[model samples]
Target: MKLDVLALSGVFDTGLATVLDTLATANELAAAQGWRTQPFDVRVVGLRRRVRTALGLQVPVQPAEVANGAVADWLVLPAIGAKMPPGLIDALATREVREAAAHLRERHAAGTHIAAPCIGGFVLAESGLLDGHDATVSWWLGPLFRERYPKVRLDESRMLVASGAFVTTGAAIAHLDLALWLVRQVSPELAAVTARYLVVDTRPSQAPYVIPDHLAHSDPLVARFELWARQRLAEGFSLDVAASALATSPRTLQRRIEAVLGRSPLGYVQDLRVERAVHLLRTSRVDVEVIAAEVGYANAVTLRALLRRKLGRGVRELRARG
Candidate 1:
């Protein structure tokens, strides 16, 4: 497959390297196994010949003018290194990003598979290709993603989602997952061999690592609700009571919460409780029943069920991992 990795200015250096290096390693590992791996002609193409990363690392990139003319089977967009909203805004408005977005649109029109992971998903989203597709972004960027691209169905919970030719994954290291997945698309055995060599464990969901505090802070109402929820965590939550205490009606609370966080108020509270339970399970020797109560569940039975439903693991299983 002819693949081009778009290396833009202010790009996160590690994310760009992860996809390029992992694919190269996959080819090597597959050959070691006496298997015929898919041919990957991966090139690091950029808007300029030399681009400075967010950390000011000087990276030599093939002039995008050159690769822009080459037909590619896949175009990979790596994450940008803007953590704050203003930085994200500025990065997206940069000349490199605009040029890259235009190229991505062209590639999609030509039927190239668009693969992006982490904050790079923003570029894909900007191209309007992800419209009406099940997509995901870096977990913390969920609200911004949804707000900026309303046409796309953004699910922050997934680490990987393949919708037709467009494949996206969540966060930094998922770039490796995307690479291995592309390998798996060619040959499952090759992906297996590459994964073993790299000690890359395949993780399906981003649920375990999502920090509610970080996501909530993006919206003042959500942040206020988070504080209120944590204070009453041991006592459980009532939507009506919460609305009254927060000086909002149940209808307004539900609407804003759903619009901003893409989850109901109840769901948000549950996330807080589950996060609390996970920490307690990992650090404390508390019994499951007591932990459940501490997290606002009436009993261990319900908490265990919720844990299985939300985390895909039972209480004992989570404890075992800890």
Candidate 2:
């Protein structure tokens, strides 16, 4: 496949490398297995011929025109890294991002398939290509994405979402999933072999890894609630109590949270509890029961079940890795 890795300015260095190197590795594995899969004809392209990544690494890329003229069967958008929310907001409004959206619109109109990982989805969404189409973005950016692109059905929970011509993945590392998906589309057999060689596990969703605390700062009411929730996580506070603490009506509190965070108050608190439980599990040498109680769970059994159901991990397994 003729693939163009469209690296915009301020792109995440790791994301660009991940897509290119993983696909190259997949090709090598297929060749070793004597499979006759067509190798990926991948070129890194940018709005400009060159750009600096967020880490200040200089990367050379083909001019935008290189992606045209049937040279590209698929256009890949890698995530851009921004240190702060303001940084991301600034990036989305930049000429580089807008040019990327325009280029993607043109390419899609010309029948080129589009695949974007994490924040790259913003570029595609800006083009209106994902309008009325189901898409996925980094879970932490869920609120901003929904606010900016309401017409596009945003499913931030999914690890990957494929809506016809477009394929989008969540989380920064989801480029791994996107690469495997692409490899599979060409040859499931090769994809299997490649995955085995790479030890790429099947990750179905980004929900478990989402940290509500980090996302709460986007809205003031939510931020205040997050502070209150964290203080009372072990005690368990009711929604009405939380609203009163924040000096807002329960219904309005719910409304503000739902509008920005896309999570119910209950869901938000549960996620908070789980996130704290995970930290204790990974960093603490204490018993599971103690850790569970510390996170407001009554017992280890409940926490264990939540870990398994949400993160697809066991207590023993998490500790061993930690």
Candidate 3:
């Protein structure tokens, strides 16, 4: 497979390196293991002839237009260094990034499979190709992405989401996952071998790593609701009561929470409860049943099911990891 790694200026250093290293390792392992599939032909393409990473390291890159002529089978966009919304917005508004987005749209039109991880999802969304597609971004950027690209179905809880020809992954390190997924497309065996050699494990969901409070604070109403929810974790969540306490109607409260967090009020409470349960499991030697009660679950069974649903892990696994 021919792949073009689009390296934007001020790109996340680790994200770029992970993509290159993972694909390079796959190529080596494919040949060494005598795999029938051909090795990936990868090149770093950029808006300019040279660009610097967030850390000021200069990288030589082939002109993006040159790569456009070759029609790479895949175009991978690594996260840019704009870690925050304001910085990311500023970066996206620049001439270079807009040009890059235009280039991305062109590539997608020409039948290149597009993949981005972390803030690179922002670029894909900017190009408008992710519209009407199920995608994911860095969990912390979930609110911004949803608000900015309302047409795209944003599921930040997923570690990776593939929709048609566009693939998106969560956070900076998910670049490895994206690369492994691409390798899997060619040869699942080679992908597994590459992952084992790189000491990388499959992370299917970003839910376990999400800090609900961080996302909640993006909206004042959501932040207030989060505080209220945490204080009442041991109590049954009542949307009417919460709305009354917060000086809003239940309908308004529901709309705001759904709009801001992409989940209903009760769902956010469930998230809070799961987060608290995980914390208690890690920090306290409390029994599972007691911890479950503390987090508003009726019994250990209920909490276990919830943990498995939200985190894809059991209490024992969470405790061990903690």
Top TM-score prediction, candidate number? 3
Off by over 4 Å in 1: 35-38, 65-70
In TM-score terms, candidate 2 sits at 0.85
Residue pairs that clash (backbone atoms under 3 angstroms), model 2: none
TM-scores for every predicted model: 0.93, 0.85, 0.97
Put the candidates in TM-score order, highest first.
3, 1, 2
Model 3 stretches with alpha carbons more than 4 Å out? 35-38, 66-69
Global CA lDDT computed for model 3: 0.92
Question: How well is each residue in 9-94 modelled by candidate 1, as lDDT tens digits?
Answer: 88898898888888998777767767665467787888877887878898777865435466788888889899667889888887
lDDT of each: 0.86, 0.85, 0.92
Best-fitting candidate, measured by lDDT?
3
Candidate 1 global CA lDDT score: 0.86
Could you tell which candidate, 1 or 3, scores higher by TM-score?
3
lDDT of 2 by residue, 207-250 (tens): 76787777888888899999999888888658899888889999
